[model samples]
Target: MTDSITISVDAMGGDHAPRAVIHGADLALRERKNIRFIFHGRKEQIDPLLDEFPKLKPASTVRHCEAVIAMDEKPSQALRKGKNVSSMWMAIQAVKDGEADVAISGGNTGALMAMATFCLRPMEGISRPGIAAIWPTLRSDIIVLDMGATIGADARQLVDYAILGSALARSLFDAESPTVGLLNVGTEEVKGLDYIKEAGKILQQASGAGFTYHGFVEGDDIGKGTVDVVVTEGFVGNIALKTAEGTARQVASYLRTALKANWVSMLGAFFASSALNALRRKMDPRTVNGGVFMGLNGIVIKSHGGTDEVGYKSALGLAYEMARSRLIDKIGDTMQRFPVNTAPPELPSDSEAKSA
Candidate 1:
């Protein structure tokens, strides 16, 4: 690891491309003085933005790329059309070529995942890569994995997710032995599908693993911070993630409606404005914007496409922290430490597998 870290940016990926991306990088650079950037996008658009932030110019280098991947474009189509020419591909290629420590994009999630996997490749011994998200909880935050990277994980893959999520918790939270849990229908050992139960057994017996397995965690346990890391297959993880996001918004909406219901309520809200602001900050999705692609050879972060500079800055901050902590190396070490003796044989339901 070096004192200075270089990050590759897909400047034209988001809805507010080039401008928001560049501004966000500048914001991140202001906080992390040791960070540098390699911006991949059109010269005409990126040059003007770079000129706006004088401090960012010296710390950044722009690589001209003509193509852009559409948010709605299919992964296969994006890869075929924009492999070498798109800004997203160039950003990821920087990581592969060792020009950057980490790569980030606020683009199409599927496209970014496809390009990253194609360019950087998965880590050694990893059959499928997982996307890990930093999830907010009552106590603080927990790391959740397979947020939509690949679907239908077998017992072995579920165990792999446990390793990946625990590494992330270690890197971000600095937990020496993070408590991990498998997301299931019930906390009982006999609950959940066969693969889930098998994974539970493997995790239960994993002695030298970097994390402590806390048995099965139900969906409610996620928000309560029952464990430091939550592991699940993409099918369930994605649904859980979206449901949480939606529920957050729903709660905020309800609060706003209640606050404005009557003059007395409005007065009460005004009186508690400071506390309300704090609550709003805690609930903001932008505060935890990055979705990290774990089990990959290089670090790649995906930000929300519609997010503003604040959200993008949060993503960049995550990238800086992951790179500074040597997240890939930590994950590699943890993967090696994972016990592989309890892997279950093939199951029938896991036949129709899909990568996200």
Candidate 2:
């Protein structure tokens, strides 16, 4: 626990791998001068990149691991074969061993989750983990989760998401008490799946605990900042995140086409160049690159596997911020005040399971 923050990085984890990881670390150093890096990957791959970043050289060190988790590897396969040997696992181990404040990887999401869950384990009372990501919005940004950590979350798990997400919002936004909501088809109590309704009931009763709980918010509310934190099961949350990302790209494509449609439009675009630049900044996916793993003992920031240096840098920046904010301690403190119920959701009857 030095004054300077140490971030453990999975240097061999992305599509563009050690190169992007190294470059991103260098970029992050410019933003935070008091950060150090513990890079885990092949020495041959990382050593050459150090030559390119003289400033980063002194603040960084390498731990070589021969295995690199493949992007498409199954979670089970990764755990069984590469668990302790892979760069991804070693990076997470650094966090568990108190060598780093945070871990960042542009690796297989499923594999990372598997390794992280095993190595770091869940926080004391957290039954399941949720992958939380920042959603850019008109007002500012919102945190959305269970971004595919598990396929579905039960009522209690959903409440855990609200508490966990609120902790994240408080840390990221620096708000003393942040708002939270449950994503549903409608605002009505009668709508949505049974579990979501159950979660809402619990959240409403727990509002004064630490957050302002908005009863129900639809998909459209996500972009309106209706709530600082939006909670949902992993399957739907993942789909929503992908849809939003796709929509942003589609909108950017449309703008590009419209601006070049004619001479008059092109002239209009020239006049609106500054505004367009602002719009581009708003829509850039790289700006919101990392997905924070909630309910874990330590912080792990998951970068998109295919992202470039810009996106990787954003992920590293996010990791640095979470570490600086003491996000894990905040989450633990919040959970202590708002203790999560340990009861598991009721399993469907044998007949019911067979019928579907």
Candidate 3:
């Protein structure tokens, strides 16, 4: 629906640089007729992969750069010292120059966030950009925000995250009035820390304006489908996400082993084949491969570092949907309506915030 949306991907950002990344670009081209990709990395690294998939020749283009920022490098140091780093710098430049609708990477999380914050900057009224991850719930998906972005946030920042998360749920999932819940240790109003208690009060008072503010939601309520949006600071949200992911994988593994243990169970597995397959599909991380960095001037999707072709393709699919949805403009307009009360905390002075 968008005017042939172009996505710029960091071809060498992940652990399986060039190969997996190029395969992903090829997959996106083959599947989406209107989408184009600008692969940023070394030509030597990507040329062979492109040669293997000739259909990618016309639909995609590559911008060659020499340097590479390693996975372990500190984000601030990388941004300053690695000026010519192919994936890092090119991805930023492409978005800034209006050459791409979105930029995606499966590289270092800190570096990617740092690059995005510097290159695109936050929207006019956004204090700091937040990351939103879609978690599977019983009834529907829950959109949780500030997932490792702003670690220790104030009451006002939490409220801002709630607004941003609520808008995302409304826009992306078409929830008329999304239920917003604050993640806390207990469901009681006065159970959480001082900051959380204060945030809950503010959210409860402002309920009728935007979303349905459900007082408190504990860790047990995450996948129970109790709330549509869960608002928490980055530290807790990240831990929650990682825990959910690990638990899902462990459950699947245990099921598989148990089913193959005995002849009786093997027979049961046959009868439940379709049901098990459905469950596996629902739980597959590849199906939900893209995570959006909200409150930014441009659309940015972060893929998993260990993603294969399937995950890569899914990211591109997400990018296409986000572009068609006009999410950037929608988010900008939303920020204009409900702005952050306080400005973001300033970055350390010695750290130079480079664009790419």
Candidate 4:
């Protein structure tokens, strides 16, 4: 394992702001002796919270900055205007300067993704840096990419996403030959868009790549863990992620209500308490709090904005795991061996570049 990994956190990023963020940092520092923290936010705002817990003061340090970028701000505008903003620039600068091994944030997703791309750039052949979120399944874990990073993707880009997703599964999950599946409306070859069908062929014929191409997987099959990695454009991937989350919440609610419906049912709950608790543990989102921004030069993790101390602590734990796994370097090496076909679109003339 790597010694003493340092993480720079955006103290003002989450829904709970400095309080939950600080608490999580303090908890992480206490639990992991080899980890250190750099809190990026205003000292005046964060110092009062630190004073409440004296023990953490000795181990962690803060880099004071005055401003913060709002969650609703546009990505390009925020990065261009908020140069001195604590949440946006400070965390990126820390990674760029090698002051921190990884930078974790729960800030505006758009702003965070844009700034990371602009500052760190992508691994040599990667067209776009994607966000990979691990989805829990009955059989094993499934890694999904481009959850919200890039919007529309061509056939070549989808193929590139599959390669990137495969590399992530190998490094993070230790799958010897990770299975790759393209997300589609149906499992058949003659389904969805032309891009999906064309991309499927490329993935199937691709040689020297370590991935096991499993063809197409439907949305319903995602929770079954039928494959190791699922590739899709950001639009479909984001909807899949949200739908899974919503469904989980609904199922948990129904289970709780059913268990408490009557005296006889309540008694049964006691007998099955261990099994019930285990099921809850497996389904809880808090257990896996951070989603990794893959294909970047350095590790950048984004935690849920609604996270509490426990969720935030899990994010820190993930950051440590990625660093020790040397995930970024592994992806870079893999890309070098089997380069992605699609390159990022070139910038057009100044007049043709405005958003539609």
Q: Flag the better candidate by TM-score, 3 or 4.
A: 4
lDDT of 4 by residue, 1-356 (tens): 34888888888898988899888888887788788888898889888988977777766788888878788999988788767565657887788889888999888899889888888888766777788898888888779887989998887677777777888788879986789999999998888898888778777766357788898999877888889999999988998899989989998999999999999999999999999999988887988888888877888999898989888998988898788777777676556655334333232224543542
Residue-level lDDT tens digits of model 1 in 246-320: 999998999999999999999999999999999999888998999999988999999999999999999999999
- Write down the TM-score of every candidate: 0.95, 0.95, 0.90, 0.91
Question: Between 1 and 4, whose TM-score is larger?
Answer: 1
All models, RMSD in angstroms: 4.9, 5.1, 6.6, 6.1
lDDT tens digits by residue: candidate 3, 1-356: 34798888888887887788888877877777888889888988888788898888677788887877788888898778655565776886787788988889888888888888888888766677889997878888889888897789888778778877887787778776689999999997768898888778767766755578998999988899789999999999999999999998999999999999999999999999999999988888988887888887787888888889888888878887777677776565444544223434322123332422
User: What is the overall TM-score of model 3 with all chains considered together?
Assistant: 0.90
Flag clash pairs in model 1.
Answer: none
lDDT-sorted candidate list, best first? 1, 2, 4, 3
Q: Name the runs in model 1 displaced over 4 angstroms.
A: 341-356
| Superior by TM-score: candidate 1 or candidate 3 | 1
Scanning candidate 4 in windows of ten residues, the lowest lDDT window is 340-349
The better candidate by TM-score, 2 or 4, is 2
Provide the global lDDT of candidate 4 against the true structure: 0.82
Best by lDDT: 1
Model 4 stretches with alpha carbons more than 4 Å out: 339-356
lDDT (C-alpha) at residue 299 in model 3: 77
Q: Which ten residues in a row have the lowest lDDT in candidate 1?
A: 347-356
- Candidate 3 regions off by >4 Å? 83-85, 208-210, 339-356
Clashes of 1: 0
lDDT of each: 0.91, 0.89, 0.81, 0.82
